[model samples]
Target: MSVKENCQKIEERILKACQRSGRKREEVVLLAASKTQPVEKILQAYYCGIRYFGENRVQEGIEKIEALKDYKDIHWHLIGGLQTNKVKYAVKYFEMIHSIDREELVDEIEKRASKMNKIQEGLIEVNFGEESKYGVKEENLKKLFEYILTKEHIKILGLMAIPPYFENPEDVRPFFRKLRQLKEDLEKDFNVKLPHLSMGMSHDFEVAIEEGATIVRIGTALFGERI
Candidate 1:
């Protein structure tokens, strides 16, 4: 299918998920996970009415951002593990970082944002005890939130998680639910509103939306398998 057709199908699914969960369609942001996609394909998605794009690597994201600089309306997001050295460029290029899993990254983002005099918004990545994922464990989430609260230049917008993959999307529901509950618990504990839950990917986004995902990162389902 063409990008336009793929987008139509995805939009329909998003709408259905929103209806199932009694949420507004406008509440969820469809972020194209344009990790390895070429700039032309990215633009195809843009013309198809997708304004949000996510990149997994800082350097790749920078190249795309520079390439697409003329399209000022596009919102770029960093949705993968970030190295400390890339924080400066990540802060300057991406509107939000969705893999903040450690205190060091928080400190680095704060410093970079302060240097640039910009408020860097981010999501705390919570690991579901997955050995391979890069995220703070659920038990340490509060401590991380407390530490992040002290940073003047960085803001925590919500939580993100890349749950272990399951062929059945329903099996992933509990992980999404846990992430939503964590977001709620943090809001109550800190009296802050974290509005974006950056969870879900191509295979299970509908489930994520049903569990309160405000941002759904889609790649293959939108752009086809990576070339």
Candidate 2:
């Protein structure tokens, strides 16, 4: 199927999942994970009513963002590892960063964003799967949240996670539930409202939606397999 048809199918699934979970379709943002996808494909998805696009690398995203600069109302999100050196470009191009896993990275982003005079919106990526993964552990989340609040240039939107891949999408539900619960606990503990839960991907987004995913990062399902 074409990108538009894939997007339509994904939207239909998202809507059905939302209805099943007693949530509105608008509550979840379907971010087309455009990493490695061509600008033409991204444009196709955009024309099909997808306004949010996510990229996994700084330089690639920069190219796409620069090329698509004329497309108004497009929200770009960085959904991969953000290097300290590349912080400057990532801050300038992407509206949201979803893989903030450490305090040092946050510091770099804050410094760059401060210089750019931009308030960088971000999500705290948590590793609910394995210890070797690239995400903040659940235990250290509070400390990270406190530290981020002390900075002036960044705001934590919510939590994101790439759970262990499973053949059955149903198996990924726990990680989604855990991320949602973590969001809830953090909000109550810090008295802060985290409005975005950037979980889910092409393989398991429907389950992620049922578990309170405010933003689902869909790639292969939207743009076909990455090239």
Candidate 3:
């Protein structure tokens, strides 16, 4: 399928999923996960009405920005494991960082955003159970939420997670459920209004939305298999 056709397919899927889940079509935001994808693919999606794109690496996203700067109004989001040392480049490129789960990374982002005179929004990534991942464990959310409240430059927008992918996406339900529960628990305990849940990807986005995902990072489904 052509790039425009690819984007349309994804949009149709989103619209159907929203209707199934009893959500408004506009409620869920589709983020193009253009990690290794070329600028042409991104531009095609943009032309087709996709305004947000996500990258898993700072360097790759910066390269995309340099190549596609002419396409203004695109919202870039960082949805990968963020290194503290690479915070500045990330701050300069991504409007939102969705995988921030540590204080060091948050501190670096805050420092960079302050120096750059910008308020960078961030999502706290929670691992829920998979110990082999990069997100903050579910148990530490309260403390993290409290600390995020004190940060000035980086606004705590919501939570993001990458549950261990199972062959059948249904196996990942427990993980997504935990994330949704954590969001509710955190909001009940603290007065934080975490409105966004950046969960789901190419494989299990439908499940993610039914579980309350506001942002779905889709790549392969929209751009074909990555090389």
How many backbone clashes can be found in candidate 2? Answer: 0
Clash pairs, candidate 2, are none
lDDT of 1 by residue, 82-166 (tens): 9999999999999999999999999899999999999998999999988988999999999999999999998899999999999
What are the models' TM-scores? 0.99, 0.98, 0.96
Q: Deviation in angstroms for 42 in model 1? A: 0.3
Model 3: lDDT to the true structure: 0.88
Model 3: runs farther than 4 Å from truth? none
lDDT (Cα, 0-100) at 165 in candidate 1: 94
lDDT string for model 2 (20-126, tens) is 99999999999999999999999999999999999999999999999999998999999998789999999988999999989899999999999999999999999
Question: Which scores higher on lDDT, 1 or 2?
Answer: 1
Candidate 3 lowest-lDDT run of ten: 140-149
Q: Candidate 2, which segments miss by more than 4 Å at Cα?
A: 129-132
What clash count goes with each model?
Answer: 0, 0, 0
The CA root-mean-square deviation of candidate 3, after full C-alpha superposition on the true structure, stands at 1.2
lDDT of each: 0.96, 0.93, 0.88
